[model samples]
Target chain A: MSNTTHPDTSRSSDESAHAEVTVPRSPELEVEQEAALRLWVILSRAHAAIASHAHADVARSGLTLAEFAILEVLYHRGPMLLGEVQRRILVSSGGITFLVDRLTAKGLVERRNCDKDRRARYAALTPPGEALVAELFPAHADAITQAMRGLAADDQQVVAEMLRSLGLHAAAKPLP
Target chain B: MSNTTHPDTSRSSDESAHAEVTVPRSPELEVEQEAALRLWVILSRAHAAIASHAHADVARSGLTLAEFAILEVLYHRGPMLLGEVQRRILVSSGGITFLVDRLTAKGLVERRNCDKDRRARYAALTPPGEALVAELFPAHADAITQAMRGLAADDQQVVAEMLRSLGLHAAAKPLP
Candidate 1:
């Protein structure tokens, strides 16, 4: 994707033409902004790759990425209702339904009617599902580590904490 | 999404075994990891919202997001051929052809025979296309800024820079 064009053209080529609105940055801020932009670009590509990789790995065991995520949560935290899994995975109701359908078909997960709320269904990992996670977690952990390979161990920890804090804050916001 | 359950499963109503695995936090690196995860989550949501917003804006002008990006590039950097645009947008040949077809149908972009390479076709923005960008940019910018509110200016810059750097590195990787 290299744009081997005139320097000026390539430098300002991505966005549309408009007067540059100055969100003035201090020296420290400027450095950070450049880093942040780079990270955004990296994260997009990295995310795509990670999703593809995770999907491929999970598909072999007859699960979709989101379904595997649900299974992973269940494997780590025991049984969870469909709605609870949906909230944690940040998928819509319809999406959760579809995901659960696939997982149920694969026999990796089963839905049991809740005692307290008949409308709710609890999804628990089957024996095979638990086995799969046990086998896959090591590889998945490796992939996560690989994704963070560029950063120092300390920096990676910092990144994780900051990102978790940010995610909690954002999740707390009332969606418009 | 909270898993509030009794410690002893024998006494609890729910039968399934629960195995919650919250990572132990290290004083030195926990914050960084939090930051990293939170950043990814924020970006994911922001990107989803931005995609929707941009889609609506571009649809009004009768173009797909990819085509709009092409036009934006052409408007800012003058005319460029299909291959150059594909490179810049980082899409496959088939994807670019489809995008060009959609843009051409809208009269926002045109393909001209490249003088330098007979086999190549140039994709350039028409005057209407250029004008459309000029009209839409400000509104798009405002929407983006709004979505990114509450992040301090310094944090924004830092995050942007980090993301961009990461993105560039990821983009540079060879496709598997």
Candidate 2:
């Protein structure tokens, strides 16, 4: 692929500060880079191990991972605007729309007009969706608990808090 | 979508202990399950956020994430068996074979027979692959370091070690 062009290079100040990224850097910076990569690799492996079990458990319910994720959000948190669901699930608007539509076709989810806004819509799990999640969630939770049995409960707590902080900060900004 | 059967139920002792997973349980068990779920959600979010930035950086080089991952493995660690590469990258044997073939076609990688085993083959980077990775790796590293700027360097170190332990333990056993 001819990827010599960098769209960001023509962009404004936010990216230009990182113009030095393409070139060589100081030893300290290299160390930081290597450390970050190592951390990411470890994080990826841990997540992969845990997610495999979680996904398999969800798959037993005949639901895709994203589908189960949407259901779980509604089952626990109650009905919410489609936008809110999208945000919570970290999916694009179109992606959420497509999934909700599919779940709706499966008679698992429904969309309702929002009272607060004429243009907004809410996604709620139908009785079938609720029942399915209710049936499947416990097993899913157990699978996660078992997958995460790698760390002690106390250590899981610590890592949970750390990941919370890291995720919040990560969402707040990127590569700056 | 018709996922009514439980294949594991008809199987051995390894899965029977978890038969109770489908039924309701004590509050303590529920709490543990909830804690694990929370940890997993937080981990997913953190990884997604960081990976978004890293993926975008890699995309600028016109290489799919898997392809770049393979090249990086060979670039940093030198030649290795295909099976080892698959394990390190967490891809299936077929998936690694496809990526290696693609990289080889691109003139970035090659395979040679391993002397130790008649059936084993080693994947190594060609000069072009080495030059490409050497050019892109620093930027990729910088991008990672930047994406991970959410945590202090010291905390990154701590999380790295924690994830290392967690990953090792998680890989040791699927579930108990």
Candidate 3:
């Protein structure tokens, strides 16, 4: 495999003042890399574990992850128009419509025309939708807490601090 | 959504003992939870980013991530049979066979019937497969390194460590 480092790397440590602290190379960098790789493998496997459980949860609730996520926003914020939900969730406009349609078909969400804007439609959770969230949110949160069981509070805090930098950097920037 | 903290009983801290350290109650506990949530969000986004890039990479090179992973394993370790690859990658028998078929179709990998075991098929990286890895491994590594930019080395190490623990605990285990 080609291992040549690219020059146009946007992640150049020089550009980001925080780079040096984030990626300190030890004298035996090889050991660190190996550890990092093993960690990555484990993380990937953990992801698969969560995904398997998540799939089952969704199945039990009749909501896919995308659908559940969309519903989650609505559940928190009351009702919002399709474009707004799409914007907040960073999903495509068309995909949001399809998701709303499916949720509506399942009697969980309803779409109503915006009073001010004829062209706009808002999606709101129905009674059943609210019920679904009520039934699922606790279990879902419990699943999260369960997944996080082995981590001590301090370790969790430290890991959180470290990952914040990585996360913020990799986050999807809003459309300029 | 309901936000109930069950004081009487909940397995929220069930696996903490496995960790080398335990954290006492403090303000950082909240930060820890937020950080953990943020990390999950970022990791999910990163997985999507990798998969999306993999889609493009595979389309251009006629290799799926599964196939590429297999070829990569074979590329480094020489030829190996189907079952071996399946075990190493933790993919199902049908999944590996399907991936092998795709790689074979692209002529980047080939299968050789094992002499000792008639039912076993050995798969190896073709010249094109080696060339694909040579061309793509650096960019792949860069994508990961870039995704992790902006964090402190100590933070990175902490993240790696926590993720390892989380990964291991979350992995498939025998029923209690």
Judging by DockQ against the true structure, name the best candidate: 2
Share of true Cα-Cα contacts across chains kept by each model = 0.10, 0.40, 0.20
For candidate 2, lDDT tens digit of each residue in A1-176?
A: 00111111111334322234445568787667666777788777777676667667787768877888888777766787988777777777788899899999999999999887989999998998888877886667777788777777777788878777777776777443
Interface RMSD of 2: 11.0
- CAPRI docking class of candidate 2: incorrect
User: C-alpha displacement of A129 in model 1, angstroms?
Assistant: 1.6
Q: What DockQ does each candidate score versus the true complex, computed on alpha carbons?
A: 0.18, 0.22, 0.15
Candidate 1 per-residue C-alpha lDDT over B1-176 given as tens digits, one digit per residue, 9 for 90 to 100: 21111011111234435434345556444444433433334444444433344455556756665666677668767788888777766567888898889888887888899887899998888888777877864454443334334455456555444544444443444332
Number of clashes recorded per candidate: 56, 0, 6
Candidate 3 lDDT, tens digit per residue, B125-173? Answer: 8888877766765455444444444554455566667776765565543
**Highest TM-score: which candidate?**
2
Taken over the whole model, the C-alpha lDDT of each candidate is: 0.55, 0.72, 0.57
User: How good is the docking of model 3, as DockQ?
Assistant: 0.15
Please name the candidate that would achieve the greatest lDDT relative to the true structure: 2
What would the TM-scores of all predictions be? 0.70, 0.82, 0.69
